[model samples]
Target: MRYEETAQLENPRSSVSTDMMVGTALYTLAIGVFFVVFGLRKRQRWIVFWGATMVVAGAAYVVAIALGVDK
Candidate 1:
């Protein structure tokens, strides 16, 4: 294909939506909470660490989205 066609095909904005981003953030938070609870019950330090990390990242993502920082 031509370079122009390739460039046109790479429209990043069309690849995702704001709602999708929010949904992903929410899903990540849910998974983090699940892991955290399970880790606490099972007394697993690594799982708890990972869960906390993910929870913080997810919270940051959601906050950024809310603040329009992602745009």
Candidate 2:
């Protein structure tokens, strides 16, 4: 499925609150940062991959909120 469609499907009820959405976005961003830092220090490909993935996830979460999918 497409990213936007997947997001909509995952959050079908649209009952998520602003605080919860913000928290999830923050958590994902933090994880992304951690992975990027660890990847740079340890030179692990997986860490970098996870970091990029988290960044995308964070962006998607924000987009979903902006699109009013999880209101």
Candidate 3:
């Protein structure tokens, strides 16, 4: 039997970019708005909750970007 090991970098470079963060936030915001609109039209409580959650996620991403949060 052969065993394989995956090498991990000890010191990794942070590849965070402004464009990526903004793009993700914008996409999330769009999804949230869509859900909110459809939820309102359908009068579904769960859908509205999901919509709110997505909206918060989007806002959080934006705030993290602003706060320089990165891995």
lDDT of 1 at 58: 87
Model 3 misplaced regions, further than 4 Å: 1-10, 13-18
After superposing candidate 2 on the true structure, give the runs of residues whose Cα lies further than 4 Å from its correct spot: 1-16, 67-71
Error of 3 at 15 (Å): 7.0
| TM-score ranking from best candidate downward | 1, 3, 2
lDDT of predicted model 1: 0.87
Candidate 2 on 25-45: residue-level lDDT in tens?
979988998998899899999
Question: What TM value does model 2 have?
Answer: 0.61
List clashing residue pairs in candidate 2.
Answer: none
Better of 1 and 2 by TM-score: 1
- Give the per-residue lDDT digits (tens) of candidate 3, residues 1-71: 98898899998876977787799898998899889899999999899889989999998988888888954
lDDT of 1 by residue, 1-71 (tens): 65554444464556788898789888999999999999999999899999998899889999998898966
Which pairs clash (backbone N, Cα, C closer than 3 Å) in model 1?
none
lDDT of each: 0.87, 0.85, 0.88
TM-score of each: 0.77, 0.61, 0.67
Question: Candidate 1, residue 56: CA error in Å?
Answer: 0.6
Give the C-alpha lDDT of model 3. Answer: 0.88
lDDT of 1 at 59: 93
